[model samples]
Target: MRFFRRLMLCVAPALLGVAASEPLSESFDVSVPQLPQIVATDGGKAVRYELHLTNFATVPLAVRGILVTDADTGKILRSFSRRPLLTHLIPLSGTRDDPSSARVTIQPGARAVLYVELSGPLPRRIGHTVDYVAACETCPLRLEIPAVAVNQAAAVTLAPPLAAGPWAAVQSPDWPRGHRRVVYTLDGKARIPGRYAIDWVGLDDAGRTTRGDPDRAVDAIGYDAPVLAGADARVAAVRDGMVESASIARNPDHVLGDGSGNYVALDLGQGRYAFYEHLRPGSIQVKVGQRVRRGQAIGALGFSGDTTGPHLHLHVANGLDPLKAEGIPFVIDSYTEIGRYDDIGALGSKPWQSAGPTRKSHEWPASNVVVRFR
Candidate 1:
């Protein structure tokens, strides 16, 4: 009996099975919704859609693939899966999770969001569906998403304006801070896999100071905030479960360089991808092969990588490869023109934030305008 008991203990993991080889029966609560009107000029137009998936069981589960098809012809339109550049897993908390592992696990009652967009002339007709293979510790299962169409468009106005204020320069040693004189030119175009700016509630404020204060106001600001989808696209890469850093202060333990903490990369189609980095641990809200819409709630911001304070760092890149991708130029919808560090004309300017004062002299925008097309 003693020997049998020991053998059972040794075989427990095998009996329970590993995620890779096991199949389970899983139920999903899923939905598809039409998006608001999206305007474009010339030959460009925008169509938006969203997919929300929730796990109803207590055990962990995995979703392997999702596909979109045209309901009229039963022909496949777009395909999404666990690809290197087009798959992601988000937690119920709306945070991005890491995808390096073999399986995606969602706790009981957890939810994930998938936003999808098709740009260019609106399709004559469209329908969307998902293909998912999920498993628990002991069983594996497969699911086919209910087909839905992208036939409706709603009216939507531009977003609200940002706050206005005087631009105050914060000085940093190696990082670009306040303003400096540099000759730079904008790219004639923007590409997928691009990077952009993430404005923190407190860090990017025109009048706020993030340095050299005992109060550490910058540290006081929480790292987690809603991260909107920069562009319309299907869900791409998502990396979660990385531990969130407590503060941006230099830590000797971080010397080895772990890339952005938890992150989400969205494929804007046409070889363009947008990456949101330094996400809070376990805050992801989407899954692999899922679709996402622009300005949708994806995840919260956090300081998890090479950062000194809780500020969002956004830039555009060209390729899906994070290491090899090149940064691109992008414009926010709106921003105020505040005072400059070295320019007297910009001094005491109300409700503006200057990009810098050294290279070019420009005023920030006022608070009431939405940052559009920038």
Candidate 2:
């Protein structure tokens, strides 16, 4: 009920006008049980408690810090605060802030969940509360969740499956010469936020990649896109309401937190997930719980979400939660590495290396050369 009350407060006109006029700050709502209860697991051990934070502000707000303390002693029990992603894509005009600093901006009326995990030996009594303090530009806001004790098994669930494919091998014969060639160039730099791989893929009639200009082949080439299930075991989630937006680089959605305009997340077995972000919104064709064939046409490509242009943001990770998940390396079946930066090594072949001389030239590989996967 506290979360509900906070949600109402966020949309109130007075708060809305202030948030719209000034730089926003951090706030939170707690949904845990009202009465503090003791949680028992493994017959007598303390259960792990997960905390989720919901943002209801108009501008983005960063979660600068989180502190969990013993109510009786006022002693801090745990704390967590840091930017999770290695590479971040800032708007060309936006100010550059500290990387470890909480720079999260929850779009107006939108919601993003921040998670915290707490595990411990059993506490003997109830009536304790966990206090959380978070901040942005101005001052910090405090929230408290009443602790509860319960004897229940934690539920484990699998994430969606990786997009399947009649994967196409597109050619990038004229890829720019450099260690960062595969990376999208923003402000003349290659390291962008989120882990991704780039390669050329021939598009079929049903594929959106074909719509790109071919003569501007370097810009025209499309990735070997895959269609993934939104949830594990079958299709479990689908949203078909949003329409795709035209490609626009670095345009932040003033209306929403970099709207992942529309997307499908498949729950792969075992808490793993595959996220197909920025799919043409409203193009979703699959239904909840419907089993889909591999490489099925779930939707077309679009420029949505926290993106500047129309490039797919692809990754495989341990969970559906972006902030808490670890990005893992993955590969498509096959493609040719038509060219290489003599000074930099192979394309789509290595973790981003920042220490070496940047490559400046490349020659197309032989027509029949097989592209190796990393």
Candidate 3:
């Protein structure tokens, strides 16, 4: 907390006019590895980031809640607590299964991470107010940590990989398993390559993901759909001849470290690369060093890698390796939002409730929304 308190000397307190007698605040440490980046969403703007916390106190402490506020104005923007907070908090050290308590409770010398996603408009600077239940009587209940500046950098805008389809923009806010939470370590460095990733699962006219036999790859609506180049760039990496998953029930873990089966990485320049993963066997048309135009067919969507069904796993990253790189935000040039699915289990069978074909430009579709790229 000494480090945190020293950094926030110029920032406003969480409770204005109320001095925070942070007696025990100096016993703990908190930080953010990768700062929050503002991205345009279908509904509005959103900031997605994480908070890493370490406990130095001799006793255990339970995090009560977390509040996000405008740093300059001291206006409360969003708050999380109880079940909602527990769902996003993850214990990075010690045992995960403690029947008496949750993983959010930071044990002495243990570390944890808090996943946060704030929707709507926000200021350039933000502050965090964290409340904790400590064992010591001198420990203050609240600590205000500010100086977290929001990255207003514009997201890389690209063309849709699939030329035409009512694609279900599938994603979940669940941590420890969601694309946003999965991290990979390569060369002794960890990175989240799927931080802003999306699985483009195509839907048929009837709003079904597949027809005939669901287990067969040939029946999947997205199977063999032409995958296009998101931008005009040189091919940095290419992999092919990956055996497609015979059944939707198959797991690619047996293949080991081949999650991005038969993929292609395009160099988007400026330290950016676009990865198109889970492509059909022998469908990759470009080779390494080949420059492709936007909207050019690069491959076909197929059930490969760590997949349950046929879909295109597309994401932008800062490196060439699919797993080693850190994921970054990318916006579609133009797409029409048609409908949406609230539940993942009901994706194919349940028809999507239609909405006005909202023509969204230079923005990424929100999770579970249906968008048509034409």
TM-score of each: 0.39, 0.35, 0.89
CA lDDT of each prediction against the hidden true structure: 0.44, 0.38, 0.81
Please provide, for model 3 over 162-244, each residue's C-alpha lDDT reduced to its tens digit, 9 standing for 90 to 100. Answer: 97788999886673687998767678965678889999998986779888798888799889999999999999999999788
**Comparing candidate 1 with candidate 3, which one achieves the higher lDDT?**
3
| lDDT by residue for model 2 (1-374), tens | 24433212123346566544333234555443212223222123222233334545555444445555554455565564454311221212233446655544444354333222234643332222322233333444444454434434222221222232212222221233311112223344222112222222323323333344432222422332334433334554555566433334434463432345566656656655555666656567777676765555566555546544444444444556432353332333222232322322332233222222222112111211223321
Q: After superposition, how far is residue 1 of candidate 1 from its true place, in Å?
A: 74
Q: Show pairs that collide, candidate 3.
A: 1-28
Best model per lDDT: 3
Candidate 1: tens digits of C-alpha lDDT, residues 106-153: 567886545454455454455544334343333335455444544353
Compared with the true structure, model 1 gives a TM-score of 0.39
lDDT value, residue 245 of candidate 3: 68
lDDT of 2 at 318: 52
